[model samples]
Target: MKRSVIPREFFCRYTPEVASDLVGCRLVRVIRGRRISGIVVETEAYRGPKDPASHAYRGKTSRNGVMFGPPGHAYVYFTMGMHFCLNVTTEPTGTPGAVLLRAIEPEEGIAVMVKNRGPIAVDRLASGPGNLTKALGIGKELDGEDLVMSDRIFLEHGRMAREIGTSPRVGVSAGRSTRWRFFERGNRFVSRGRPSSPQNP
Candidate 1:
């Protein structure tokens, strides 16, 4: 079947809208000549300076500069000094916004994902942001990559999720009350993470 790559226009909109719409899309990563892919099952929207939990909330930095770039780009970041998380830039240029890819249902390369994630269950291979990156071989080196143009990493059209659930983002303190997290209900590949507690005054 011919692949339908998602267009940049799809991401040049409100961050929350893009985040919700991203559920069920296919995220593909090509490492060497092998293709690894999965159906996006969970996402979290971070609305730039307006979202205190966002990396761009404090203004653009070298690490978050990709968030302020054109839409449909990868904004991969290293976190906890150990893992990498993948995000897709949203909104127009100068507008800092992104949709963090929280989880995915592994698709194209199961054996490779198993090798990458060790002896984990298939459903848990890409069940969280960090593991999703690891399963697909995503890292900081792919940061700022133009998803619309890059053959190495890109998104493709997939069946739209039938039941999408929304809740506050996970592991965030300041934006704990915002229902920006979107996930496919009943998806085993979705992360089971709960929201972090609100920050102290």
Candidate 2:
């Protein structure tokens, strides 16, 4: 069976509603003659300008302008003096929203990922957003790339062997009321930084 490249083709239908479903999916990178795969374990949703924590909250600028573009685009950004994070642009052409890829568990090309992240263990090579981006060689140059068609970075489907967990996002003082972080339930690779929801995390 030729599965669609984007397992969640209609992912934009609900804005941040189903961003959690992205957990457990695989993100593939074909870089420099090597193919690497990572199992998505953590994610966060940025709900348009109204949400204070969103980068697009201040309106579209050259930095976040891509988020205003159509869905399926990569709206990656750099932060904390030296870290790059990946986000899947969401909503319509004029809406600025996205789902943040917080962490992943490397499955393929582990050696390459380790090389990128330095002598880290295969399991901890891409445990957090910064760590994962570092392990994947994802940087500002790859910003604005289209997730649906990018040869360097893309996503795949799998029968995730765990439950989908829910929680509030981490590292943001604002928009704390909205529970926008999601992860693979019981997955050891999941981020431990976020606060768990009463229902689950």
Candidate 3:
């Protein structure tokens, strides 16, 4: 199938609801001589200030300042002393809210993903936050870069992805009352289901 690249206009138009609804879209990253694409199997939503699950809750800092920038940008960050996670800036410029890409099922460029991720089963690679970023070669350098024009990464319009499911976000202490995260049900690529809420569905 031809890649369904998302246009900058569509990306810029995204709201927190739209971002949350992007769970099953395909995420594609063009690497050295390879095009790695995957069905975005999981996602999380963070509303600024009001949503305790958001990084902007602490207000914009040197690390999270990019969240204050324009939409269609990448927001990569490190955590757990060794892992790097990825997020996409949402809402308009100066407004802070984001959609966290939680998981993806490896589709194209399995060999490339394997090369970046070291030895792992094809299905296991790019299955979690850290692994997905590693497999796609995403790092702090791409942190504030615009995904709409980035030569290496961009989002595609996978209309079928709307069939995706929703649950509360993972590893969050706040915003535990509402269901905000999204994922593809039954897809092994879904990262561990340690949600902030008591239920998974």
TM-score for each predicted model, relative to the true structure: 0.94, 0.91, 0.88
lDDT of 2 by residue, 1-201 (tens): 775468335556555664776776788888887888887888889967689998889887899998888888888799999999988888778877788888888788988887888895666788778888888888988888888877788887745647777766788999989878887777777667734534352
Tens digits of per-residue lDDT for model 1, 49-110: 77999999999899999999999999999999999999999999999999999999988989
lDDT per prediction?
Answer: 0.91, 0.79, 0.77
Best-first order by TM-score:
1, 2, 3
Instruction: Candidate 1: give the clashing pairs.
Output: none
lDDT (Cα) of model 1: 0.91
lDDT of model number 3: 0.77
Question: What are the runs in model 3 whose C-alpha is more than 4 Å off?
Answer: 1-3, 12-15, 195-200
Q: RMSD for all candidates, in order, please.
A: 3.6, 2.4, 2.7
lDDT of 3 at 103: 81
Query: Where does candidate 2 stray beyond 4 Å?
Result: 1-3, 194-201
Supply the TM-score for candidate 2.
0.91
Model 3 — which ten-residue stretch has the worst lDDT? 192-201
Give candidate 2's whole-model lDDT: 0.79
